[model samples]
Target: MAQLIKLEDYVSRYEWNAYRYPSQFIRMKQDNWKKLYHLWRNEAFVGDQQQANMEPAASKWKSLFKFGFRKTAEETAKNSDVTDLPATENELRHYFLDKLYPVQLKWASSTVTEVSFVDQTYYANDRLKYFLKRFPDTFLVMYHPVFNVKKAPVDGEIILISPIGIEILYLIEKQPGTLITADGERTWLVKEEAKSETKILSPLLALKRTEKILKSILKQADIALPISKVVLSPTNHIASLKAPYNTKLVGKHAYEDWFAEKRNLVSPLKNHQLKTAEHLLKNCRTTAIKRPEWESDDNSVFPNDTV
Candidate 1:
């Protein structure tokens, strides 16, 4: 899963230490998975050999210990049934993907911070889930972030910082089988089956505005990073006379290849990537109150190597 480094202007652990949290999150996830797997294996061991032979099943659960929830495993397992245990490697993996993924996203985005003050809308949003869960862990995302420009807050599209470069993404969600036609700078035409064509304000306007803001900030910081703009519609087709000067248009046909290329990327956290993320977080407009406990004993809650 891609790490949600920032969500809106909510206080993020990444904002506390961009250089450290990514690696720490990866370790935490691994450790949690191991703990859950061991618990599952132990619960699966059958005590009665005759019953085990009669059943002949690989494993049977005595309890279902919810792995990634905020509640402790013992608490979550109270009402769960023995039949819910994952019996195979694939089943266990799917269980994690379905249930524990949200917990992982939460831990990566807002752990060790005052998450209550943050808006809860995006926590259940499908679009945000698509961005956070569909990409690799190495990809750090700033979802619908607000940046400070000349002391004015400016909203931006989704920005993804990877090991090698930055991607400014504008996701267009239209009905499946719809065709999106590029018009001029101000609008684009959308064609739906059995309905009249309509024009909507171009997504590029927002893309350009965000690009300009990022460019200006990076310039001031003297940080040179490869930046690219993408107009992506994962479920629709796009038709363009010619590609825009520096932007890439990705629609349904090419979505798989584009997605595969990103998932295939293999690299450790790069120094430049961390530096760029730190600078960007510095310029973002964040709204959060200090946790009362932290105010009393600030150093006590800082995340450690063990997470």
Candidate 2:
């Protein structure tokens, strides 16, 4: 019979830990600010001053600094706007940090480094996961599988490995506007107001690039699998999204029906479906760095040294 494997069982430790970056980054920022404040205080108050005056000033500064820091962190955390909080440690990590890790350094290097996203893509993915969990025999759903393409990392939000083919889902959250896109265009038009329209990056093109990278990775494994792209909008409606014919543009309400119909069309070869699932699980698992064996001559290397 076809067997389903949860993401935790199919992925490596590295991939599982990748999602912790968001929380870690937040903590690091807070810590760094405190360190900076202490350093500044040490340098600024070098001269001899009354202990009473110094104590009051330090207390005031500390309280103000803490209030500001807490407010800022809370805002950052709330910015995710994900309605469904993750239940497991792995899910929570991925829910908060997966999207940020790949581009965190890039944004950090930029002149304007405030990274914010309106789309609740993670929320959409979680909803899909909730639905897929019901069928443990026919589908293997992977969430946010990151791959290295030409030395650059690319993230595939959702990958459904089935008997028919591999369906890659790109989640787009609801926007406060009417969205319109034209095939072959890199930018999409969003009309938020009656008189003004803004251009945003095309999710279709992003899905295509993700597909290309995924294909390259599978090719390296000598595994040729049929692949298709899907744009899933769980909370938004596209007024006019002119996507390519090959791409499946689906909305939240229609997804369950569409998935059921697709599942029904699959051939009833249970054993074949199981084999295909196993093959993908084996090849698509992220590569984790192995610890080096302890030896006398291995002083130059550490226990976590990986090839």
Candidate 3:
């Protein structure tokens, strides 16, 4: 077995904007087995007796309700067994590659042609071809257009970690809104919204939630990292952030520029830390890009601009 780091070393506090970071993490059956076992052994089985009469707060009936809840939870957990870290990691690879493949083709099409319509068509058909060239092994970026991963060497709890910088990146896609940030703080430059979570979901909240998920996964995998997150936006929305913090924000217009800047900021982690991340990413499959739902109608948002 590869000498993995101690689980404790990977468990660090993750905080957003706040001074104190929260110790949120994923728990695994093995890690909590002892505690869970003790809880189960000491706890009563179904129909255990309790204080049936008294004030509502101190009532035996309440105790019975609590027991039911605990039993239900344990039953659900047993039935919905968590995926081993390695399997989850591999599945994530398939998930991402399925999602990202389209973007790669689009980026590639942006080059090597002038006629937008023709270029789009050709690249759309050849996405798999490019995918084959860009990725040789099991590094999934887009999706499952290509297969044979089962034939690849695979094992362990693989986590798809969102870097700590995820909050800074906004999932931009909206009609209009103003974004502001301090000089050095990181934030997404957005003008759009992904239809998933709305209610004006804060990118900060999104990133924090993503961090929590990774932590939970780490706890389950019994592995860890200094993962981060960043918000991403489209270029069309650059005009929307009238007043924004100096944090990192990128969209269509600034993608190239953002990479140029961020490239210098990826400091080297400890040698082992880097390897762990590399292992996770290498096992993943990038996603395939699906045409936006509106693309099917051909109800043309930009009639003048073809494809």
The best candidate in terms of lDDT: 1
Off by over 4 Å in 2: 1-128, 134-136, 150-152, 175-184, 193-195, 220-224, 239-242, 252-256, 262-307
Question: TM-score order of candidates, best first?
Answer: 1, 2, 3
lDDT, each prediction: 0.73, 0.47, 0.31
The digit string of per-residue lDDT tens for model 1 on 181-291 reads 977788999999989999999888999998998888788888899899999999999899988867889999998999888989998888888888888889888776645
Tell me the TM-score of model 1. 0.81
Q: Write the per-residue lDDT of candidate 2 for residues 1-307, one digit (tens) a residue.
A: 1122323222332122223322344454345444444533463255575777566545543332222111234545664343332334455334323332222222211112122221233333445434443333345455555554555545655677665677878777645444444334477665654657777787777778767766765675556678888877656555544556678777656777776675565453244434444444443424333233431221111121110
Give residue 96's lDDT in candidate 3 (0 to 100): 30
| Candidate 2, RMSD to the unseen true structure | 15.8
lDDT, residue 230, candidate 2: 83
Error of 1 at 86 (Å): 2.9
> How well does candidate 1 score on lDDT at residue 99?
48
Q: Candidate 1: misplaced stretches above 4 Å?
A: 40-82, 98-100, 104-113, 292-307
> For model 2, how many clashes?
0
Model 2 residue 218 distance off true place after TM-score fit, in angstroms:
3.7
Worst 10 residues of 1 by lDDT: 297-306
